[model samples]
Target: MTQGHHLRGIMLASVACMLWGISGVAASSLFAMNPDVSPLWLTQVRMIIAGIILLIMAQGVGAQPLQLWQNKYTATRIVSYALLGMVPVQLCYFEAVKYGNAPVATIIQFLGPFIISLYYLVFKRTKPTRSEAIGMVVAFVGTLLIVTHGHLNSLAISPAVLIWGLLSAVGVATNTLIPRPLLTKFGSLSVTGWGLLVAGVCLNVVKPLWQVHLTLDWAQISMLGIIIIFGTVIPFQMFAHSLGYILPTEASLLDAFEPLAATVFSVLFLSVQLTGFDLFGGALIIFAVMILSLDAQTLAVLLHRRHSRNTD
Candidate 1:
């Protein structure tokens, strides 16, 4: 790929992570504003509304949003991606946030990248570039610092909450791995639009929308709206599109930015306290991305023993 395309992919993925972070803050606001809000119902609404709007937009953009269903194979993949990938990701992350808190949820959810990396290593028989290996390590340390506020043992863990968090991570991996062919063949907008729509429709079978009701005030409405547009629709499109331009692992590593965005938003809008650890952690995350982006392959080969081993 050209350098310009790589830059574009990096930019899209980074921006998507930022918006997702902001959405995390927004979703947290919904929980605080009204404890009665159902996680299931909230997820259903976000997916359905965002999905419907995206389909319309996809059609307007001539993406042939309905064409995937014309072939049985593509149609089956669509359904699998929706039910197994999108549905679990959207719902599990919400449940994690609802129970364990966003910071805990985010760190756990990032396990997706590791899963992706390992998949490539074992199943695909590909080694990570030296810079990528280093970046993953840096990102993990940075994430831990940010989420734990430099206190690793400070987190309060519940069994169910932990399970939900882990599932969110698996969902992330599933979402990233399952849709590559479809995204390459179809493009991000239509796949994501249809994926969300299918997930919403399928979920409705078990948790019918009419079965749940809750109080909705303007604050709740605004938050929900933010989650739908900024959180659900826009970021997924950018993330999916970025995959066409960059490796899935690169996109996953850049996801470290999400926690940083969430931390900043929480401090600025939610009156949460920010500490030096947060700043240092955020800086490390950025530094990790910089490390991953460097084009100095020869230097990496000289510095990383694994490269020499592979060469041997």
Candidate 2:
């Protein structure tokens, strides 16, 4: 990629991360306005709005939507992707947020990359490097710190919420793994759009049109629009585009910024106070992601090659 493209990709990906990071705060705000609004209903509305907007954008750009049924294999994969990956990830995430605190839910969900690494080690027989191992350890320490509130003896976690949070991690891992082949064949935009549409349609079963309250003040409507556009549509597309210019590992590492951004937003907007323990835990998480971002072997090899060439 050209330098200009690389810079643009980085900017877009950063924007996506920023938008995604604030989603929890947005959801929290909406819920604060009316606690009566169920998570299910909110999710349904978000998905439908996001899906429609993406569809319109796709049509405007002349990108063809996936006609999965025309090919049996593609159709089956699309169905599986929607049912297992998209729907479960969203539902489990919302459920996790409902059952547990947002910080806990997000930290657990972020464990998806660790789980993916584990899967690669076990199934693909790819051994992790020292850096990766260190990253895992650091990430685990961060989780422990977060869960225990830095007090080892005061680790009082709700079993149901913990289970749901872990389930969300699994959903994320599954989604990341399953989409590779489909993405290679159908392109990320098409696959993502279809997945959103399918998941949105499924959600509508619980929230009929008449049941959805369309009337909203300007602030509420603006929040909804932001969630639909920046939170959902723009982020996914930018992420996909970034992959063209940056390595997957680099892109993944950039996403680690989401938690830090979320925490800052939570502190400023939600008045969520962070203790020393929280700071320590956040440091550990950042360290872990930084470790994972480095390719130790590649760097070592390149340095050695350079030295040899210089000597020669």
Candidate 3:
């Protein structure tokens, strides 16, 4: 890619991450306002709506959204991607936001790259270098500070929230790694549109949106609308498309921006009180991301394509 195009990709990914961070705060606020609303219900609603828009967008771009479904194997793969990837990613993150604050959830979700590294180490026999090892340790320590407040005996956040956030990180890893072929073949818009729509349909089978009646006022409706359109669809599209222009290493580094944006938004709008440890810990996590990004071994690992190196 040219310099200008590379910069555009970085900017797109950064803006997407920030929007996601702000969306985390919005989700936290929504859960607080509607105590009766389940995260599953919200996930279903957002995914379905966003999926429809994306499918329409895919068609608009002549990406052929429906082509994947015409073939049985591709259809099965997309469905698997939907259930295994998008569902956990969307539902777990929202559950984390619902149970804990946005800043904590977003920062905790940053553990995704470590999860990806471990996957390579265990399954693919890709041993991490010293820097990658150090980076993982740094990230773990930072997470410990935030969750435990530097006290081992007690957790600053609930165990349930922590579990959900960790699960979300796993979801992030799978979501990033599993859809590569789909992305290359059908394009990001098509793949995400189908994945999200299928996920929403399956979740709806479980939760059944019509079964739960929510009496949302205008403000709540507005926030929900913004979450569906700007947060869910737009950012997802931007980050996915940016992968075409820039290396995933640069994109992963920019992922740290999500937690920063979340922290700022939560403090300003949600009046979240962050301890000194929280700030220090969050910084450490971001630092680890940079370390992994800059480290040659880590960059080599990041550049390793899933099945075929030539595809990348």
lDDT of 3 by residue, 1-312 (tens): 699999899999999999999898888888888787779988999999999999999999999898999977778888888988898788999999988889988888888878878988898788887878999999999999998998999998899889999999898888877776677789988999989999999997786898988899888887898789878899998898788888877887888889999999999999999998889999998999778776744545454555365343
**Candidate 3 global lDDT:** 0.86
Query: Which candidate model has the greater TM-score, 1 or 2?
Result: 2
**Model 2 steric clash pairs:** none
Candidate lDDT scores, in order, read 0.76, 0.70, 0.86
lDDT, candidate 1, 185-275, per-residue tens: 6777888888888898888887799887788999889999999999978898888788789876577567778877877787788776556
- RMSD per model, one decimal: 6.4, 7.0, 2.2
Q: How do these models rank on TM-score, best leading?
A: 3, 2, 1
lDDT of 2 by residue, 1-312 (tens): 699888887877777877777776666666666666566776777776777777667667766664545777677777677777877666677676665555556666777766767876787567777887999999899878876876788664566656776777777877776655567656776777777777777877767755776556777777667767777888989888887887666777788666666777777887766667667776787778668767534433433454455335
Look at candidate 2 and tell me the lDDT of residue 30: 63
